[model samples]
Target chain A: MTSTLKTFMEEQLPIIESHMYEFVEDLTAPTSLKEAMLYSLKAGGKRVRPLFVIAVMEYLNNPTKAGYTVGAAVEMIHTYSLIHDDLPSMDNDDFRRGKPTNHKVFGEAAAILAGDALNTLPFGILARLEDVSAEQKVELIRLLSETAGAEGMVGGQVLDIEGEKRQLTLDELVRVHENKTGAILRFSIEAGAILAGATQEQRNLFVEYAYHIGLAFQIKDDILDIEGTTEELGKTAGKDVASEKSTYPALLTLDGAKEKLAEHATKAHACLEKIPSNSKYLADLTDYIINRNK
Target chain B: MTSTLKTFMEEQLPIIESHMYEFVEDLTAPTSLKEAMLYSLKAGGKRVRPLFVIAVMEYLNNPTKAGYTVGAAVEMIHTYSLIHDDLPSMDNDDFRRGKPTNHKVFGEAAAILAGDALNTLPFGILARLEDVSAEQKVELIRLLSETAGAEGMVGGQVLDIEGEKRQLTLDELVRVHENKTGAILRFSIEAGAILAGATQEQRNLFVEYAYHIGLAFQIKDDILDIEGTTEELGKTAGKDVASEKSTYPALLTLDGAKEKLAEHATKAHACLEKIPSNSKYLADLTDYIINRNK
Candidate 1:
């Protein structure tokens, strides 16, 4: 990535994090629940979701603080999903982002409630959005709920967990990844399109880009599990193999998985080419996704 | 309580249950998640919350099917709270409504996800309400989320869990109950008022009515835990006492708790009297709150 790209990320990342912190620092919650909500939220993240909201709004020439609201809400949902997924009964992961999981630090009950609180806060935040029309806010909420609910993230998590017991074919694996991980990521990408009132043609192109990147993101994570380290990945490496969960590298050779990643990246770029916006920045974000060590 | 009141509950309860079942029977959710959600939802609730929505809307002369939307949303929150609360990590209860808890039937991870799904369903449901304006819908969502989320039900659960090891004073216990139990009940009542665009004067009166009945409801629950049987209650009897959780009967004697229930029930009726709508039926419902054996 260019120095300009890095600078853009450096500038935007903290704004996303600052908005997240302000959102979490509420008075209604007990200190513990608030602490639990803020703990993982403030923990380092790529700020990819929030950035998508902002970038999409910017691309449409309607950059507004509403993007920040939508961005913070999505981030809260993403962080909550992670907290619940790491519970002892679920992934049993002791660490995430090189720090103890929410359940590890807070007790299981508090962790669960923290996840619950974070999940519910989004609706309240979206409902209270002053910048958006009520219709738009409701639409945003519908998109978000559909992405996060039973048929989306939770359903995908179920498939992923059940897949641990046996080898899943590429199709089954795709379904799991799409729901478990892809759904939210796609929402993150296309949410900007939805918020910015992109034309159907533009929205379709963004979705096309989102789909390729979503698959590429998961394939890269599977590759990273094999090739990356605990220090670099910020979590235990080789967990897929240890858990016997199916992965791109497990089904396809490491070379083949890397080839698939490259294919998706190329395809994602092709979609970006068709868009009218100065998607040069989006292309840079995609490159960052591709080149990130973590 | 009049036979007419029994007739009212009998007729309305099934409608509420049927609506709840229809809401849960979505085509999008995975079968297991849907089953887990439906399992608790169909476990034969008394439909108190839905009835509140319906009745309050009727009292405001704006009765509509949207009350079912609000009712279903709040019940989903209530049921989700129960699912999470009954987890082995939290209350560790084995049964609810005389059946195995969600975790026991669907496994802990599914239970957690099921709870999460149910929690998210409310927003989509409320956001889709056809009868209410977008502004009213947002207001309804805000009220429901506040009551169901951290400041309301989840916060109360945290307080209740924290108070498990210590004997709480009456004030602390009431605060816990008011949040944990009373908040949602209040929402159930005022959600209709908000939906119907109640004047501030009427809203305050409804709040007064809801507050008294909310306390009465909790005090009666404490009394039931002591006086009712496992079969009668459809839940393990004396759970609060066994867990050393404070209760009205524990702090106030059984007689004292009964007196308190009567006091709140009477106060609730007085508030109902000032309201214009033939709230005589609502008054009857308060009497039932005092007289209910289970």
Candidate 2:
């Protein structure tokens, strides 16, 4: 990671982690339910989504405490999706981030409720955000819902599941990734812009930047499933190919997938260039996305 | 049912149904996902929760189109909870409302996604509510996430699941029902009051009324499990007793449970009386909750 980006993560991640943990901890839920929700939140994953939110805010030099709250909310959403995706009925994974999946430890019922609770909590977090205006909260909630709901993450999941049963074309794969991963990435980036009060022009540019990075993020994931070790990736590796699930490498070949990733990386950089901010961290974060093994 | 409620249902039920169906239909989501969502939605419940929202508006004489939107949102939440509750790892029910459960029809993954989507769509609905102010939308979303999320329905669900392994004390059982079922019912009543511009005093009264009816609603459900036929209840009757689940009748005895239901009904009625509005429909709905066969 670039020193600039490393410094940013060093400063922000603890704050982000604490906000997420404290929020879940403070809920007046049953102890077991709270534990289940916390199990996955505490289960370490790269806080990439929240970082995107924070990075964008920092780039604009308009950081707010609400940004961290929003960051926490997005991370919660990501955590919930991971929990549900690992369910016996879904990916049926036994582990994630080097730890047993939520369902593995909490059992399927608790895991499902944990996922459900995590999903519901983010909007509440956004809704009760004190630093942002009511209108901004409304906008954030609306955007998050659109990107995360049926037409967004959930819908994309359905597509991905359906894709597993067939050989999807490149266009179809892109569509799947766009919704499954791109939607939330878009929210993370755009939300920062919204929270930072970015200009319409800057917001538009960030959306383009988000589009490229989202695909790059997923493409790197597919590439890592093949190229990285299970220990390094902190999860079962190469299971995508074992299951004959359609992935970038399956369709494009490894070299072609790398080329595609680089293509998006360049485009993402181009979008960032137009944003006219100290986007060094965001630019480095983009490099981090392409280079990261996990 | 009282003629007031009968007329109210006849007039408003169609509106509620259409609003919900159209909202899902118009979404730019996968067709199959939409179908899965709509299948359970169309499976037909009593529409009690949405009706509560609308009935509150009618009672306050400050009805708005947003009331129906909020009603539809609550119904979506109710529908989503039912879908998840009937999952294989959860209640494992084969049927609901005389039809196959969501997972039975759509497979486990799709049903889970459908429930997730439904859980998410409500906040978006409220966020984009045309007639309500941004502040109100924030309040509604905050209220929803609290009542329907970890500290509310999901927490209640965890308690209910744990309660299944052993007998729960009366207070524990009430806590279970309050979060699992009562939270959403509370949201329905309070959302209506918020949308109708009710005074704080009126809102407080509705909350108290919601509390009473919430317990009454669950108590009636337990009674129906014993007394109502599978055909009448549109689900497996007597399963609670069969599973030796700790329900009101299980702890309080059927007679004690009925008396408790009556007590809540009386309290609910008293709260409604304190609100100076045309509460005839609300009163009838309360009666319907206490005495309904399904």
lDDT per residue (tens digit) for residues A1-294 in model 1:
778677877887777788878877864767777888889898777778888777777767777777888888899899999999999999888888989898889889999999998888888888988767888777778778888998788889888888888999989988998888888888877778877888889989988888888888899899989999989988989888887779998999899899999999999989878876764567777877777778
Across A1-294, the per-residue lDDT of candidate 2 in tens digits comes to 988889989998999999999999998989998898888888877899999998899889898898889999999998899999999999999988889998889899999999999999999999999878999999999999999999999999999999988999999999999999999999999999999999999999999999999999999999999999999999888899999989999999999999999999999999988777765888889999999977
- Over all chains combined, what TM-score does candidate 1 have? 0.97
Measured against the native two-chain assembly using Cα atoms, what DockQ does each of the candidate structures obtain, in the order listed?
A: 0.77, 0.94
Which residues of candidate 1, in runs, are more than 4 Å off?
Answer: none
Question: Alpha-carbon error at A184 in model 1, in Å?
Answer: 1.2
Give stretches of model 2 more than 4 Å off. none
Which candidate gets the maximum TM-score versus the true structure? 2
- lDDT string for model 2 (B1-294, tens) is 988789889999999999999999999999999999999889888999889998899899988888889989999988999999999899898888888899998899999999999999999999999978899999999999999999999899899999888999999999999999999999999999998899999999999999999999999999999999988888889999999999999999999999999999999999998887756888899999999989
TM-score of chain B of each: 0.96, 0.98
What TM-score does candidate 2 get on C-alpha atoms? Answer: 0.99
